[model samples]
Target: MTKGIQNSETPLFLLSMMMENPEAAELCFPQLLNNSCRKPLPPQSDGMLVYIVLSFISLLTVTLNLLVIISISNFRQLHNPTNLLILSLAVSDFLVGLLLMPAEILHTEACWFFGDHMCALNYVVDFIITSSSVGNMVLISIDRYLAICDPLQYTNKVTLDRTKICVCLCWICSVLYNSLILNNFLRHPDEQNSCYGECVVILNNITGTVDFVFTFISPITVIIFLYARVFVVAVSQARTMRSHIATVALQRSVKVTAKKSEMKAARTLGVVVVVFLICICPYYSPTLVGQDIEDSSSSSPFVVWLLYFNSCLNPVIYAFFYPWFRKSIKLIVTLQILQPDSCNAGIM
Candidate 1:
């Protein structure tokens, strides 16, 4: 009788200890005992809700970006220097949907099961995608600036071949820049880690500041300045065109047609830039506050998701603004793309 009571009490004590000590209660590697990180254990209901919502977002991002890729790549009419930049941006966004979003979901809700090397590689990839996306936006802004602010010079200056080269250089520079920035972390992923299950990379203050300026401040400044100039010129042109409407009828009509086309393109690309800024600003809020930029754990998941969600939104913008995108989607959905000479089909 005494022995049975003792055994019952022992089990109860162990259970109570496990319940009290959160770290011991849930571990990523139970066998490691003291070495492993505690696994995050939010309430089951909250966890389920987050997973369902984020998974849906990830799926939507993938689908939307895939459609953009198909639309721009398949239509010969859509092939131009400006569309090439859009294609580059879409590819970066597609990769974010494909690789980064899912990985982020797992990082937020669970433990790092893929080990340290993978963690380093993941960070490297993330940086590359981010940098490339920013570069493409800069290129898009410059393309619009030249088209709107200097219509005659635009044709000679921005050709398809030159745009293609610029796109290639953008990607290559992103890779090289991120590789240099993340070299230390990539070399020693576990150097700063306190436990087995968490994956984190930290940059020193100087490096963080430099990255913040180049990645966030400089690009944003350029974008805003170029767009501001474009706006002023656009308004001035509108006023001039209205005033001279009666004087230069035939010649003005010809020039007005071209100007209208450029203005429309400028307006659409402006929307894209505005949306990009909205999504990205939150992700960099920490840096703005002088905090070290730690992407995996220290950053808010909502901000991170918002940034990733921007990729998903770009194609939706295109669909709403560009009739060609809608028509291409219909063609793609009906499996008409598989037909011969479909690329020559009138999309624009």
Candidate 2:
């Protein structure tokens, strides 16, 4: 009602017709056959297979991100700045799985039954989730950079309270920024619809370019630059530790071990950043080639799904690389988390 369907009529009548005569679905809005979008053909075996795969991915995304949220939120020992940033990312990715993924599947394979205003709002939520995810990645990179490059001041510089504040700011900015990007579309939700039942948004060259640079290029450059510096400093510190190990006794050895752990964490998070870039690159290929990102309720299936797949992979990465994550998962899976004073249990 809010977005592009001022003249929508007898939606139930169309539904009843479709129920009575399956062919009635040939027109999504049968009353306006000349203008309504034609329904997609019945699914083939391959189409069914694709649906199965995408549905499974949606389920996995929700489950994995939920576990990550639970693990981070419930465990007192996991309440550090880095983990807090991760918790924020998990919340955004959880919404992606719970809302965006299903919407993608529904719109791509079938008609968009929701009105145009709903379509506009859906894309706004999608942008907020995606942009905040990128923000989280940048924050993670900065956190790693500070930890590895300036270890002595890292705890003071990146405190839990400050990180919580930054996470709140990141989400707030995402909501505001994406709202601006989609403002025109929200005002005229049906501007790009070629026919009834179509839900699409048009991004002109200028707006698309601005969005491309701000959301993609600038953040990526910062991440790569920071991680590069972190890598160089980590290498120097490793050499220093190895060279001084024989000369220094127990006290120095403890410091060296601590530095090594920080460097290891840097390397692990570096892998995550690399994976994110890889999954996301194809999504912006059009923009990289000077094309606008014209999207619909469904959008491009392959690249968009690949982007959503990144959410699923993040938890898997933690499962493999973070011992603490695995341990927490075991505790949760076995229902040990329900025990008295479980939050105080030693996880690290």
Candidate 3:
């Protein structure tokens, strides 16, 4: 009969050996071995400090994402097509920080305290949120491409309805990709071999190579290609605008102003793409060599921690790329500081 929960036999053996066996000569080694073949378990390596740091970072990310979401959503003037994409990204990141990270931290400590159902649900939610986040970044790239390359066409075609449709499609595609993983693959947790964490991979017949290919490699390829094209289009558009202005040779002041504005817009999109690449590369880099890692479960913290960096970055990127968010923050701060006086006036 199936136990319907992860078997910790493997980890127990590993953890036990680590804690039980201690060699002074081996203690001189720089690395801690979570998995060793020694008959006696080695000393228990406490990951409590790591978990506490991760939890703090996760809490900070959640708070920032919430502020971003609320700031964007509450400001009526910021309800444009591009900001819509930003808001979607915020929502996905917020869920990662709020819902996923806590569970992950707990699992890191307790080694999967949740049962099978919870595990499946956690995996599904994680897949959905992560996939959606990647998809949203793609959507943002396309949106910026249109805005920079074909300004007039962007104004005409990038309507609110179209933006909504794009976001909906992003989420749908994300859910579909995750669905593929769950349906074609995924195994019941092994009571002996597995941890009780949510979203723990059922490492069986399927290789990490398969997971890396479908989940990381494919999507990353798409993102890189899209951003490349977007950059090309943006550069071409900027050159075209510059040429047109040079030919017309209107007033010097007007020409300079137009050139500066064009340059500014191009620079904004450039920075956004660059930031996207930087933030996502760390998280996905492991996917390339994930199969080679000696201990997959223990190495997961590298990717998980890198992913947490991504959740925190989106808010900072928005604050940098979009001035509206900064203005909104200033407004919110000023209003909060004045609320008491306004209340007193109203009461009087």
Candidate 4:
């Protein structure tokens, strides 16, 4: 009777151990239990809430960016050089929403179902999109600086053709640069994985340092410097316009109109730059403390999500500041775009 009681208690003890240790709950690969990664099993309620929130953000990002793309592409009046740059940005942001966000959500919450090649591809695409976004911000800053400080030459300098060329070059360079930076990972996607059911890519200190400097430090410095000059010139222009308002009526009217346009553009772009900086800085913070700059799969979910959230915020900023965007969105939602000659619609 005692032996029978001990046998029953042994099973109960094993069951209790399994319940207490989270890792024993579920294995991603039951066939090779010890070699496989444990499935991440967050609390049901918390998991549902996280999924709902992140899914909503992802859907919203895709929708908003798609609207921006359609708005600029459909309207002829919106086909200016600045709008073209915005269009490029929207494309990158759209990809982030469609591809990167979902991938990141999975990376944060689930095991890797996709193969090693896919993991490498995902990171490559991520890097390209990120670099392109930064490049576009730098371009927008330069465009604003020229428009404000060199108004007389702005028209000639920032033509649509030149803008198109610059956008193409920016994208091409991003692909090449990121490919070179992450070459090792591309060659061996599973090199850093500790188990059979895991996917990870590790960057050494040297690679991390190089990526930090080129992608973060250099681009941010350029953006800040250009915007600083733009701020000073914009202030000077505002003061000049106020002074001229008292002296010359007709002459100041034309100049004031032009300057105001430039100033307005500067203010709008300034908001975009500031928001971009805010989102991007937290992502680099880990690296600043001598930590290796890991990607979404291995990095802090909060920091990664914060950076991805910037893509969603950008279109919101445009809609708030640009009347044309509001009008375009209205037309789009109303299906007015199906009408004849909608491309010629006067949004501006």
Pick the winner on lDDT between candidates 1 and 3.
Answer: 1
Indicate the TM-score of model 1: 0.90
lDDT for predicted candidate 3 compared with the true structure? 0.62
lDDT of 4 by residue, 222-318 (tens): 9999999988877776787667546466545545765767678789889999999999999888788898777745678888899999999999999
Residue range 1-348, candidate 3, lDDT tens digits: 222323444655655554676552233111234421112223254555666678888898898888778776766566778778878988998998998888776555443434555666776787788778877877777776666555546668889899999999988987876777665333553333332222345433354456566656776677677667666765664666667644445434443553465445445655655665666566556445543322223446666667656788778766786676676666566775245433222110
lDDT of 2 by residue, 168-248 (tens): 999999999988988988888887889888878877889999889889999999999999998787777778776864545
- Give me the candidate number with maximum TM-score: 2
Cα RMSD to native, each candidate? 7.0, 2.9, 8.2, 7.7
Error of 1 at 299 (Å): 2.0
Winner on lDDT between 2 and 3 is 2
Report the C-alpha displacement of residue 185, candidate 2, in angstroms.
0.7
- Model 4 stretches astray by more than 4 angstroms: 1-25, 245-255
Candidate 2, 107: how far from true, in Å? 1.7
For residues 1-348, could you state the per-residue lDDT of candidate 1 as single tens digits? 000111334656656666777556687755455887788777498779879988888889889989988888989999999999999999999999999999998888888888888888899999999999999999999998998887767889999999999999999999999999998888788887778888888877877888888888999999999999999988978887878746466546544864678788889889999999999998888787888888776468889898999999999999998889999999999999999999999977
TM-score of each: 0.90, 0.92, 0.70, 0.90
**lDDT, model 2:** 0.85
Misplaced by over 4 Å in model 1 are 1-25, 245-255
